[model samples]
Target: MKTGAGIREHGATVIVAALSTLFASTLILGTGVMTAALDPDLIESSGTFRMVLLMVSAVFIVIALYVGAIVTANTFATIIAGRTRTIALLRLVGASSRKVRSRVAGEGLLMGALGAGIGWVLAELLILAAVTWGPGLGWLPAGREYPRFDPLTVGAVGVVALTTWAAAWAGSRRVGSVSPIAATGAAVELRPDAARGRTARTVWSIILIILGAVFLTLGLLLGMLTPLALLVAFFGGLLSFTGIALGAHIIMPPILRLTGTLLGQGPTGRLAAANAVRFPERSARSTIGLVIGVTLVTMFAVALETYGSMTQIAFESDPALAAALAETLAITTAVFTGLVGFSAIIAAVGMVNTLSLSVLQRTRELGLLRALGFTGGQVRRMVIAESCQMTLAALGFGLLLGVFYGWVAAQSLLGSQAGFAPPTIPWLVVSGIVVFGFILAVSAAVAPARRAIRVSPVAALAVD
Candidate 1:
C-alpha cells in the first residue's frame, strides 16, 4: 500500500476503535447506575421495578459487549484477509504471516485499551444523567439518594477492554494461515467440512425454535409472571434469533436480489440490495441481537403503560392507595424504561459489531477496487452505505414488529372491555431509537472502512 493509502486505512481503524470505546464505557456506567437504583429505599418502597430494570439493563450490557467484541475481532480478521494478497506478497518477498498477525493484533489491542478508558468516563456521565432524569420525572421516591462514581465501573471497563483485545487477537488468528498465493489474487480457500455441518445445524435449529415457541407460549399463558418466566422469555428469544438467522441464511439472497432490482441502480444501491440477501447468518445474527432488545423494550413499554393507568385507577378506587401505588408505579416505570433503553443499546451494539465484521471480511475485495483506482473515500463510503442500509432496513422491520407486539400487549393487559386506542407514539421516543440506530451503525463501519483505505494498490493487487 502507498503511504497515503496506509494513512487512510489506519485512520478508519482508529475511528472504529474510538467509537467502540465510547459505547462500551457508557454501557458499563449505565449498568452501575442501574445497579444502585435497584435499592428500594433509594428508588422506592417496592424495589421490584428497580430490580427488573437492573436485570434488563444488565442484559443489554451483555449484548453490547458481545457484539462489540465480535465486530472488533472481525474487523481485524477482514483487514488481514482483505490484504491477503498484500500479506502473501510480503510473505512471497519473505514477510512472515506471524509478523503480519502480530502487527494487526497489536494495533487492535491499542484501540481496545484506549476505547475502554474513554468508555468508562462516558459511562459515568450516563449514570448521572439517568439518575437525574429519573427523579425529574417523579419516578424516584422522596429522599432517594442519587448515584455516585465507583471504582468498580472503571475496573469493569478495563476488563472489557482487555477482553475485547483478546477476542480481536483470536479473530485475527486466521492471518497466520492466509496463503501467500491468496495475496497473489488467488481465491480464499473454502472448507467443505465446515459446510457439511449445515444439515445437522438446520435440524437442531428447528428444534430449538419449537422449544422456544413452547416456552414463550406457556410463560404468557400461565400469567405466572416471575424472574423465572423472564428467563424463559430470554431463552425463547435467543433460540428464536438463532432460528431466524438460519432461516435467513437460506431465504434472503433471492429476496434481496429481487428487492434490489426494484430499488434502483448503481454500485451503492446494488451493494445494499445484494447485501440484504448475502451472508444471511451474519445479518440474522445482527437482527437477533436487535430482536432481543426490541422484545425487552416492547414488553416493558406495554407493561408500564398499562401499569400506570391501573395504578391511577386503584388510587381513585381508594384514596389510601394513592401515594403507595404512585410511588411504586413511578419507580418501576422509570427503571423499566431505563432498562429497556439499555436493552436497545445492547441490540444496537450487536448491530454495530455485525456491520463492522461485514466490512472487514471484504477488505480484499475493497482493496482490489482500490487497486483498480477507487479512492479511499469511496471505499469508506461503500462501507458506511452498507452499514446504513442494513440498519435502516432492520430498524424499519423491528419498529413494525415492536408496534404490533406493543398493541397486543396493551390489549391483553387492558382487556377487551377497556375501550381505548393505543397510546400515541411519542416523537421523542421514535427519534431517539432512529438516531441511536443510525449512530451505532455508522460507528460500526468506521474501522473497516479506514482499514480498506490504507491498503497499498500494489500490495492489494499482489496480495498472495
Candidate 2:
C-alpha cells in the first residue's frame, strides 16, 4: 500500500521543483502583465525599445526552461535512484513494471500539482514584494504601477506542472528496467549493456554541434541587436552550450580523475577522484544543471558589457537619452543575468542530494578508513576535496564556454555598430560566484560528513 512513499520522503526534490516552477511562472506572469501594461502599440512606435524588452523577456524564458528541465530531471532521477530498493521490493511482491512506472508517474503528478500551486503563490508574493519595495530600493522607476492579477499566471503554473510531470516520467524510465535481483545488491544496473555504442553518442554530439553553429550563424545574419536577432543568438548559444555539455559528459571521467589528481597529493585524492568517475552518469547528472546555468551567466555578462559600451559610443551626442538608455539597459542586464544564474542554485541542490547519497552508500568504506587511523578531520577533508574538485571542474568548463559565447554575442550584436568592446569580464561577480560555489560545496558535505563521523568505526564498518 505504501510502496510509493520513497519519493515522498525526499523533500529536497519537491522543494527544488517548486522553486523552479515558481521562478519561471512568476517571471512569465510578471512579464506578461508588465507588457500588457506597456501597450505594445505605444512601444512599437519607439523603434528598438520594444525589441529590447522582448529580447530580455525571451532570454528569461529560455533560461527558465533550460534550468527547470535540468533541475527537475536531476531531482527526480535522484529520487528514483534512492528508491531502487523499494521498486525491487515491489517487483518481488508482484507489482508489474507498468505498475511501478505508474507509481512513479503518479508521484510526479502529485508533486507537480503541489509544486505548481506553491510556485504560483510564491510568484504572487514575489510580484507583490517587487511592487511594494522596488521603488524604495530604486530598482523600479517611479509611478510604474504594478499590474493586476492576470489569467496568464494560471497558464504559467500549468506549463510548469506539465514540465515537472514530463521530467519525472523520463527520470523513472530506468526504474522499471531494473530486475528484482538488484534490490539485494544496492545498485541499479545503470550500465545497460556490457558495452555502449560510442558511435551513436559521438554522432549525436556532432549533430548538435553543427545545429548550434547553424543557429549562431543565422543569428548573425538576422540583424544587429534587434529582438529577432538576439533571440536567434540566444537559441544558438543555448544549442551550442547543450552540445558542449553533452561532449563534456563523454570526457568527464578523464577530466575528473585528472582534476582529482590535482586536488591533493596522495591516496585521498585518488579515492575521491575514483569516487567521482565511479559512476559517470551520476556525476554528469550532478553537474549538467550548473554547467548550463553558469554558461548562460557568462554569455550574458559579456554580451551586456559589449552592448552598453556600444550604446555609449552610438549616442554620445545626446547625454540625456544616452544616460536613460544606458541606465535602463543596465537594469535589464542585471535582472536577466540573475534569472539565468538561478539555474546554479538548483544545481547546488542536486549536489546536496548526490553527495549525501554518496556518503550514505559509502558508510562501510568511510568506516574502514576511520578504522585505519584516519582522523575525523581527515574524513572531513576527503569529502571536502571531492566536493571542491566537482565544483571547480564544472565551473571551469562553464567559464570557458560562456566566454566563447559571450564573445560571439558581443561581436555579432555590436561588431558593425562599434568595434567589439574589449571582452567585458565581470570579475567581481564571477569571483563572488566562485566563492559562493566553494562555500556551497563545502556546506553540502557537512551534514553527510558529520553523520559519517558520529558512527563508531566498528558500527560503520558493519553497516550494510
Candidate 3:
C-alpha cells in the first residue's frame, strides 16, 4: 500500500541520500587520486602523510553522513505526519504501532539501499571519466595514472545506507502515539500542547546540554597540556548540538515569535507568524537544517580566525614559521569551507522538501482561507514571510552557537601556546550568511507558495 504512493513522494529522500553517498565516495576516491598524483612514493617513504589524508577524508565523510541523517530523519517525520490518518486506520484494523513502525523502517532500508547503489555507481563513473581524461586535459599531472577504484567506496555506501535506516526508525517514532480512534478524524499534525508534553525528550535534552558544557570546559583546561583536548571538545560540541536539535521545538518558538515581529503586523504577516508558532515541531524541523549549515560555516570561520590571531602573537619573532602557518591556515579554511558546502546543499534540499510537504498537507486550510476572501498574493506573502521568519531565527541562533563553539575550539587547542584571546569576528562571512539566508528564504518559498495559491477553494475543501 505504501509503495502505491509512487517514487515521486520519496524522490527528495532518495536525492538527499544519493547526494550524500556520492559526495563521500567521491571524496574518498578523489583523495586517493590526488595523493597518488602529488606523491606516489610518499606511502613507501612515510605513512604520516597518508594517515593525515585518511583522517581528512574521514572527517568529510562523517560530516556528510551527519547532515544526511538529520535531513533524512526530518523528511521521514514530515512524511509520517502526512500519513497520520492512514496509520490510524491500520491501527484500528489491528495493526500494532510497533509492527507499523517496523514496516516504515523497512521501507526506509530499501530506499536507502537504492539511493546508496545509485550514488556508488555514479561516483565510480565520475572517477573513471576523470582518471581516463584528466591528464590529457591537464586537469591532472602529465605523467601520472590515478586509480579509479577504492575498496573504501563500498564502506562509504554501506555506512550511508545504515545511517538512513537509523534515521528513518527514529523519525517513525511518532507512529506509536497515533491512537486508533484518530482514524475517525481528519488528518492533522500533533497539536502544540501534545508537542510540548514530551517530558522524556525534554529531560534528556537538558541532561545532555549540562554534561556537554562540563566537557567543553574540561577540554579547555586540559588543552593547556596537550592538543588532544580537541577530541574532548569535539565530543562536547557533538553532545551539546544534539541536545539543541532535540530541544528545538522548545527552543525555537520564542525566537520565531520575536523574529515574526520584524515582518510587521499586517494580516499576511500575522497569519504567517501564527502558522509557524502553531506548529512548533514542524517549524523546528524545517529550520534545524539551516541552523546546522549556518552554524558550521560560522564555527569554522571564527575558529580559524581565532587560531590565526593566536598564532600571529606566538610566532611574531619567526618570519618563515609565521608565513608557513598562514599558508596552512588558508588551505585548511578552503578545505573546511568546501566540505561545509555539501552540508548546506543537503540542508537547502530538506528545507524545500519540508515547505512543499507542509503546503500539501494544509490544502484544506488554504482553500478555506481562499474562500474567506484572502487573495492569492496574500497567501504567497504569508508563506514567504514564514520562510523569512524561520530563516531569520535560525541565523541569529546559529551565529550565537557558532561563535561560542568556535571560541571554545580555538581556546582549547591553542591556550597553552599563546594564552587566551578574544574571538575574532569574521564580518565578511557573517554578511555572506545573511545574504544567503535572504536568498534561501525567497527561493524555498516560491514553489510552496505557488502550490498553496493554486488550490481550488471548492475542490480543496472537499478533500479529507
Task: Return the top candidate by TM-score.
Answer: 3
Q: What is the C-alpha RMSD of each candidate to the true structure, in Å?
A: 7.3, 4.3, 1.8
Error of 2 at 397 (Å): 0.6
Of 2 and 3, the candidate ahead on TM-score is 3
Which segments of model 3 are wrong by more than 4 Å? 1-8, 40-43, 46-48
State the TM-score for model 3: 0.95
| Rank list by TM-score | 3, 2, 1
Q: What do the candidate models score in CA lDDT, each in turn?
A: 0.57, 0.70, 0.85
The TM-score values for the models, in the order shown, are: 0.60, 0.83, 0.95
Number of residue pairs clashing in candidate 1, backbone atoms closer than 3 angstroms, sequence gap of 3 or more or interchain: 21
Clashes of each: 21, 0, 0
| Per-residue C-alpha lDDT of model 3 across residues 1-464, encoded as one tens digit per residue | 44634463476778887998899889888877877777555657435655687898888778778878898888888888888888999998999999999988887878888899899999999999998889899899877767888999999888888888899899889999898877765546766898899899988999899889989989999878777888899899999998998988899999999999998889999999999899889998889988888888889889998988888888989989998998999898878877887787888788778877777778788889999999999988988999999999999999999999998899889888888789988898889989988899899888877976787899879766
lDDT of 3: 0.85
